[model samples]
Target chain A: MESVRKKRRKARVDETLCVACGCCVKVCPLGAIAVVNGLYARVDTARCVGCGKCAKECPASVIEVQEVEV
Target chain B: MKKTNQKHWYDYLWIASLLYLILGFFNILFAWLGILCFFIPLIISIVRGNKAYCNRYCGRGQLFSLIGGRFGLSRKRDVPRWMKSKAFRYGFLIFFFAMFFQMLWVTGLVFAGAADLRQVVTLLWTFKLPWHWAYHGTLIAPWMAQFAFGFYSVMLTSTVLGLITMILFKPRSWCVYCPMGTMTQLICKARHAGEKNSDKSDFVTEK
Candidate 1:
């Protein structure tokens, strides 16, 4: 039997749907989210502490926090 | 056309918050009530999307704007670019958390019998402030004292920021750098990242 460890969850954005509205950018306490190329929202996972503040502010309902198995 | 700003009813909430702080001198629990005001909204914003608490119910923000508008207390200057920078905001957040957790650690030590309650309370600058008149000669448990000290520490931090920003720039300028605002933003970011793509209408249901 193999045991799988669950890594910490992080917030990620669905780029295709992100309108680059910058709501998440303004709301992120850690400054982990930014609008890239003036088109979509991007998340800096390395900098993101997974506080989930931005997800609540996304008007498009495109951002989500996900769990990863490390 | 130049836009004129309008004041809303909730802006008076700051006055109410101020009253609450004043009342702390009579009954210290009012200070704890102030903590609950921030804590409840913070929890709601984290569990739900968007910072509804800040948008709908921040008494401090309202008070800042109210006094700024009525008394011309604000400098009417823009918040300096650097103060709004991510580095400054996040750096302050980190510092706040460090101090908060340090206090909690001290509380833990007190509970574990390794520290004295009186000494630990002194670690909080506001402990000896004029407001504690209500606290003396009262039968408060050690844990309650520790909690009160923690609340005082938090309030002192906000008051310092509020005073500096309210004086140097526009009123409510502290919102840009508030640690609680930053924490709420982090929670919103994480929630947005974790949720599945859906229509905006689902926003209400998602919560």
Candidate 2:
């Protein structure tokens, strides 16, 4: 029997580069991103479908979509 | 996770907001510069199809973040539900535009010699506070000065309101219902809809 693994695309934020401007928060259809503590943008990976809207909308260009094994 | 506390050039824009207020305080003419604040966001939204100006370049927002977040002035409470509601946000945007149009109308009247220049700043759209001291007669037309005063009043009033909200709630709470933010959001939505329609048309043509 061979073990099978599943992979999915998810959006991730570079905490260092994020400006916490809330642009991602507005553009996210799933409402998975938020400006935390008025400091940086935090993306909730579970709800994020890797749509790339937030990545495109981010002014700082800190967000990226990556394939992850689930 | 290590968070980098790096500062970007745009982060320093709060100084511009402070300088604007200071310059306006010394000379009412400087208030005319507020036009940049009025047009820049809309232009960015139309040209770039995003809210980059509100997110990255808003000096007033940076100022509030500095005061309310860095200085610990904000209670950090979430803004009231009503304030976050679409009805309230749109209502505020409409009310803001009404006030803006009224100011422009007054400026037009002054330009046409239909009304005298009023050297007073109306605070919160109600109380008219005398701002004559800031106005020193210059070589420019009185109507120009009139527009400056009116525009400055709008800018100053909004700034005061933002500071109040910043202190009482989250640092960037004012951004939630900011007229410029609302306008840019609408523009972005319109652009998004237009793009979607075009995509649909392309798909249909291909089929």
Candidate 3:
């Protein structure tokens, strides 16, 4: 039987408060975070390593990281 | 307009770094100093802000822009889609760390008398680079040489990665996948969080 991988944490952006300053986009190592349409930050869960860089760098404190089952 | 064209302090640091890289070939200690460029900037970014090191002192990135722009090597081509993918960058980071830890582990083995230093040095071709001459055939312990080898490996790897991407895509394209840049960004974020928390406490006290 194949072993199951543990759930991984991913960063999520609350679009409502995001100023879209692109700070998170500038800092994400994997390019997992991007500013869409110059409006708000978005995280591509598939690309996010749950490293928490985006959440920490978000000046608005609008990003959060949570564990999810894949 | 002349003031705007004035050379920044970081421009000098970049030139110093280039000189250090050449001098490091004679003394591994100089090489170690050269490599400190990464750590020093990372520390500044954490304590000051993300832009501290990146905007002010990253000589390599500046050089990339300078040369890439002049020679038209800095193409506007979109970075290869795969290069931007998480799998590639994360995999590279993981692989880099694995090699790093492996070198450290071997250093431990040498200390334990379980491994020959020369044999260990031969494990990676990178270990024998001529730039490591300062540590060779001297009183310096084999492990020191090994440590320097490992450190230089990481530095050279990052430099090459940046160079390739700078030539193939935009001058700053390597920033997209740089592990050190990511680490500094993480540090910068933590600093911001702390500042925010303090501001919140101050607000509570004032009210």
TM-score of chain B of each: 0.78, 0.90, 0.74
DockQ value for model 3: 0.03
lDDT, candidate 1, equals 0.62
Docking class of 3: incorrect
Model 1 TM-score (B-chain only)? 0.78
TM-score of each: 0.62, 0.74, 0.60
The alpha-carbon RMSD over the true interface for every model, in angstroms, is: 12.3, 13.1, 13.5
Cα lDDT tens digits, model 3, A1-70, are 9989789999988765444445465457776665543234577777789998667644345678999988
Candidate 3 chain B worst ten-residue window by lDDT = B198-207
**CA deviation > 4 Å runs, candidate 2:** A1-70, B1-4, B194-207
* lDDT per residue (tens digit) for residues B1-207 in model 2: 222233568768889999998888778899999999989988877876566676667899888878887798987665676786668878999999999999999999999999999989888988898888888986889889999988889998999999998888777778877888877777766666634322221101000
Cα lDDT of model 1 by residue, B71-176, tens digit: 7787756566677666887898898888778777876876787876652223234444444554664476665666666666577557766867777776667766
Task: Order candidates by lDDT, high to low.
Answer: 2, 1, 3
lDDT of 3 by residue, B24-130 (tens): 45655454665577678666665555444554466666666566655667654546656655566567667766877886797688767787654222223253444
Candidate 3 residue pairs in backbone clash: none
